[model samples]
Target: MKLWDYDAFILDLDGTLIDSGKYHAQAFADAVLAQSGYRLKPYEHHEFFGKHSIWFAEDLNERYGLSLDPQEVLKHKRERVQEIFVAELFAGAQAFLEFWCGKKTMALATNSPLEFVEPALRDAQIFNCFDVITTASDVKRRKPDPEIIEITAERLDVEPEHTLVFEDQLIGIKAARAAGAKVIAVDNGQPVNYPVDVAVHTWNDLLKLSELHRWNPN
Candidate 1:
């Protein structure tokens, strides 16, 4: 009865697998202000969490009428982030990955570019858990487009329907579901008016697998 029906897993990097949201939020605010002369309020940055860095730049550019390049904006943020980035695994992130590693084929999909994603995963000591990893540069599109997840599934040689994705943001949940994968989300203290196959307040809920089998992610 405790058996679940997922064949593969995809982990989201930022708030889902690691506790980098706080650092990322501050760095985003700093980078945007330094580049665009527009400062994002706390509410705005909180809403911006887990989004593609390039998307953030594009949104900011459109909103502020700035001519900042998305790639440059992302690069600036990465510099700030890399200076202070330390991987703090979210609750049960390690245990969850450890529990699922051998049981399921897995990969990581993120909108973050390699400059940021690689170091975070390494610092968390969970880098080896993934069989493959994909970032924004790896695909033509990022989250909310489904391309990244689909690409990850392709690289893993797994069907989308068999891939179960864990995410922290609605954008990622939307992307996973659009790519035909079931999604489990971490609360990250954010609002989730959207639906996922499962949503848990902490990774501790991931440790409670009866919860997963109860939902039957099919």
Candidate 2:
């Protein structure tokens, strides 16, 4: 399907629109180390990038046999994120969102909590572009569970089948698929083996496509 064919667009926050992956990873790493004395390897941080902090904590508990409380870990991670996280949007992300803000229904669906998401959106100056914003605090489950995406679509009054999700991680892709939305894998140089309707290296590519479609009705 063409990019404009979807009734709504749902975007993931961290890696998809903003370049906040490393900062989030640092917060998680710091939390895990302080709580359980187990420092996460750099590569291991990527494995939990798009999910909730509780998932990361629980997985670490199971994998390393640590009895750390998920809530406590999450709290520490949030604290660290608040202290060190700086919001930075990927190139062309703001322009792309601006281009389609009014022409199409848009929503921000992310596994990150409101505290993390709000500042990032405001910093990027695209907070008003979304018709709805669904974060981790809004759902019982995060990405890979479909609850977040499902809630976002419901809030937008759009059908999952008619929505297109732009994601940078496997868990987000899985969630979008489970929610019955078409997927556009944001290629951030990470290898994605899963199937998607399309893949682009940056939002600049989509911006160009939107311009093309706008200028050419046929």
Candidate number with greatest TM-score: 2
lDDT of 1 by residue, 58-157 (tens): 8777877888777777777878888877789877778878877777788999888887788778878888899999998898877888999999999998
State each candidate's clash count: 0, 0
What overall lDDT goes with each candidate model? 0.79, 0.86
Worst 10-residue lDDT window, candidate 1: 192-201
* Backbone clash pairs in model 2 (N, Cα, C under 3 Å; residues 3+ apart or in different chains), count: 0
TM-scores of the candidates are: 0.86, 0.91
Pairs in steric clash, model 1: none
> On residues 45-117, what C-alpha lDDT tens digit does candidate 2 reach at each position?
8776756778778988899899888898888988998899888888888889888988999999988888889
Predicted structure 1: clash tally: 0
